[model samples]
Target: MPSLVTPVLPSGRLNASAQPALPIDGDLLLRPWLASDAAAVARVFEDPTIQHWHLRKADSEDEARAWIEQWRRGWESETACHWAVADVGDDRVLGRVSLQSIIMVGGQAEISYWTTPESRGKGVCSRAVARVARWALEEVGFHRLELGHSTANVASCRIAEKTGFALEGIRRRALLHTDGWHDMYLHARLHEV
Candidate 1:
């Protein structure tokens, strides 16, 4: 019989300091979310797509600020990390990318993201996702990164594929949306040694 063992974190573990601003091409930058970005973040949540997929709604700037605060806590606790995807020229926030459900001992985490309505169809999410995945696998030393999206979300499917995540199959009734139970498509990318 073979013994099953999980990978453990190295000496100091992952860094939870200031989130790095990852540049994607010349148009997009993934930087840490700011307290001043509350208004913009609130606006992004106004889109029906984001509201539907994410379930909860941030109707006010205060709610959005709380969301940012939560992400900051996640970083400080070394449990998750999030970045705001911004336009390089003007520094306008375009979207968000987060590495959630982190398990340092297992060398794995789940990725989630959403783009403002204006930023859609511009490859912002795809580029940001790819950049973050690279950082997670190489710099952070995570062996695997997972992403899940509602089966009906074609855009998410395209983004996952563009970022090199292989389709791992579906989880029936995995999520509950306002409409009802929805199936989710699971995808993952593994770091090659």
Candidate 2:
């Protein structure tokens, strides 16, 4: 039986090629996570603030390495994509950006990110996210990108706005944190073409 609506993105659209490294201006790059980055990735999750917002930690370098492998699998499966935000000069890890919960049929995915403590307030997160958003919508042909964060995370809300993800509304008690249940602010951007 034929369906009435066409898939927003055809299957195999993403896994057809290897993921590419994306440049952010002259100073930053978004690249695939490498095994050597495991230690730094673990350290990033050790930050109290990161743990608070993300609700999980790497715990050990081995665990972080496992995460790196998982990211590779995500690319192969076309279910999600992750990138390490790195310094263009030396490729040192500065942060991470990802498209999660991808739905090729709907042309949608959720954006998630976090920055190293040293990179916070430096506009690294916003710049990287904006670059990824543009690539997803324009190059990858995704129709919509969504971002959601705890309402109490003012910094995250600012990032969403800066990256052109307009606030849609809030989800009541949508997520759980260490403290308790929290409301989440949802935002989204759509491809114009």
Candidate 3:
């Protein structure tokens, strides 16, 4: 197991007063979430599979707007490094990857990702996850990275495994999704190798 780390971060308790520019994919030219991104983000959430993975039921633009706002707040607060991933070639928004739970002092963070349902099983998420993981470990100076996914979401589990995250253990009844309280696999990656 990787050594534990601790970096102070926001409690994720408040909304940010403003927006902050975030890093885009190196190979892909992703843009940060803008006020205009509400529609797109809503569309992603409307995908049954995506909603199932995220455990957020589909709703109208009004509901999606609230959630997107929270995501935006996370970015502006520096509590989470969130990005809206895109394809460099065509500037298509593929999905999003977040380096949340950042512990700057300890060089550690946790990662999460979700891709457009149409883009599933194409290695899109895997490549993007790996890219952000590498950036966090090397460029961002993080020494450890962690990820988790619903136990039933084999694809996400596979993504974590493919990205070099070690299966730490199961968090019993951890996620209350459409399936109710479901087990979750917690994975971690560290610079120690």
How much is 135 displaced in model 3, in angstroms?
Answer: 1.1
Report the Cα lDDT for residue 24, model 2.
87
Q: Write model 1 residue lDDT over 1-193, tens digit each, in one string.
A: 5437655544246563566778888888898889999999888888888888998888899999999999988877778889999999999999999999898778889999999998899888898999999999987789899999999999999999999999999999999999999999999999889
**TM per model?**
0.93, 0.98, 0.79
Using TM-score as the measure, the top candidate is 2
Report the C-alpha lDDT of model 2 over 1-193, residue by residue, as the tens digit.
8868898888889888998899989999999889999999999999999989987788799999999999978988989999999999988999999999999889999999999999999999999999999999999899999999999999999999999999999999999999999999999999996
What are the per-model C-alpha RMSD values against the true structure?
Answer: 2.7, 0.9, 5.4
TM-score ranking, high to low:
2, 1, 3
Clash total of candidate 1: 0
Would you list the C-alpha lDDT of every candidate in the order shown?
0.89, 0.94, 0.73
lDDT comparing candidate 1 with the true structure? 0.89
